[model samples]
Target: MRQRNKPWADDFLRENTHLVIPSPSEHRGKWQELFGNNNPIHVEVGTGKGQFIVGMARQYPDINFIGIELSKSVIVTAAEKVQDSDQKNILLIQENAENLNEIFMENEVSTIYLNFSDPWPKKRHAKRRLTFHTFLKRYETALSPKGELIFKTDNRGLFEYSLVSFSEYGMLLNEVSLDLHKDHDPENIMTEYEEKFSAKGQPIYRCKAVFRGE
Candidate 1:
């Protein structure tokens, strides 16, 4: 889906540098210092519209949440939500997921969330998928030794591909759900896309996996 250009996005980002975070790479491994706490850090790779991150931060006050989004137009909406939430535990970064290692050091992140990411369905674009092996390697490096990766999506093909990718990468699958909303998990924080799809009776697939250490 093409993003609609928001004319005021630049000004909004400039005014809310505190929430959107400028020069994120400079902070690198010192994220704990930036958050002013030693609490575990959880990241949402494509935090669309900030719903999931904000909801997660509200539910887990002790855990720090960082949202990475590449679009200036899309992230502006997320930054607005974060500012309105007034939650100290949530931060946003307008950065590409491919550069995850550049912004975080090994063992710096405790958990990574991939929620409703673009499937990049074309065979030629398979590498662009967030669950592709290359991205998995980046996540593995940045995550702690026992760090967990939670993924949710409405795309069956992408979910299957991710399962195969995770298996090939030697990651252990902790949990897999083909119909996430069937159980109506109270702890589950729904993203904007999740709500839209699930409301239309679409099945949501979710999985939690951890890297296998040598």
Candidate 2:
């Protein structure tokens, strides 16, 4: 059933023009060509089906948005959704978050979104959690000194563990909400996964954490 939805998803993306990315890999600095002018970049990891990043690009025309997802099939769906939106300021990339540091230059990204990352609930697999200290360090390296990380999840344990992890790393907690959908936070965005999970009567936990001054 889920696989059946892929075509429709791709079709929707094709119809939406706003979710298109001209070229995503032109920013390596090794290439003689610079892709876009110095626009503040915002990234969303695990952008399931493109609802969140594409919506943000449509809402904020000034800033640029990049949606990175590990699954090729999923990213293709996301790309299609973005294509339907016709947003020139957005880009879609098929890549894992762990290699993010290589794809982006230091201080290149202004903001990042970690939406419902895998919890890796098993004790033995704790290191694989997206919010783990190692991953956070990579994010710190990629982010600008003032860059912010907007993390949202339906898992309470992951949220709690992430809170401690951020604190231990000396990252500043700029904002947090136990129930994101109900909190009325102006900056909060509702993603495809977020809408589905919340529809199931789940509380959405979210927070903004940032690395301290350089």
Candidate 3:
């Protein structure tokens, strides 16, 4: 992660922060207070440029949204977008998704969004992929009972691999679309990456996997 112009980026990250927790670990038990109500909290694992979560927050005011990005530079961009809008229900946190459980308690998150996550295509880096078992375990740990896991990607191999991984873990899938734009799902929202890659004639795969284990 690159160091951002703290003075320039400070205003963005501090915007709409009626209540801000300095540490991710502090959020482990108080997600409800952060949103000013007991609204269901949904998360986007890799919010690029913040379009998806920002749009979702506008569309669904009753639901709280938090975006986690590993790169501070990209998060600074997302923070800028949040500063541009009036979204009291949306927040961006800079952190790697691998340590997801550190910030959220078991069964705390109502939903999980994985948008165009890193493919890490090389054979040696398969475990680094967001869909890998290692990452999924952390997601499962943070997710609420029967919580939703919505994943979208333009890479076919990752989508296919995710499908098998979900099945292997005995997760239930509700909306499984190999091509999102073609499927016409009402609840579906297009992220920045989805829009970009699709404009170039690429197929966008999407699915919602729910945890059923107790």
Sorted by TM-score (best first), the order is 1, 3, 2
Look at candidate 1 and give me any clashing residue pairs. Answer: none
Residue lDDT tens for model 1, 154-186: 999999999999999999999999999997778
C-alpha TM-score for every candidate: 0.99, 0.86, 0.90
Better of 1 and 3 by lDDT: 1
Cα displacement (angstroms), candidate 3, residue 135, comes to 1.2
lDDT of 3 by residue, 58-140 (tens): 89999999988876567877777776777888877778887789999998999999999888889899899898888889889
**Weakest ten-residue segment in model 2 by summed lDDT:** 28-37
Cα TM-score of candidate 3: 0.90
Q: Over the stretch 89-160, how does candidate 2's per-residue lDDT look in tens digits?
A: 777766778888877887788899999988989989989998899999988988889999989999999999
Report every candidate's CA lDDT.
0.96, 0.79, 0.82
Score residue 199 of candidate 3 by CA lDDT. Answer: 93
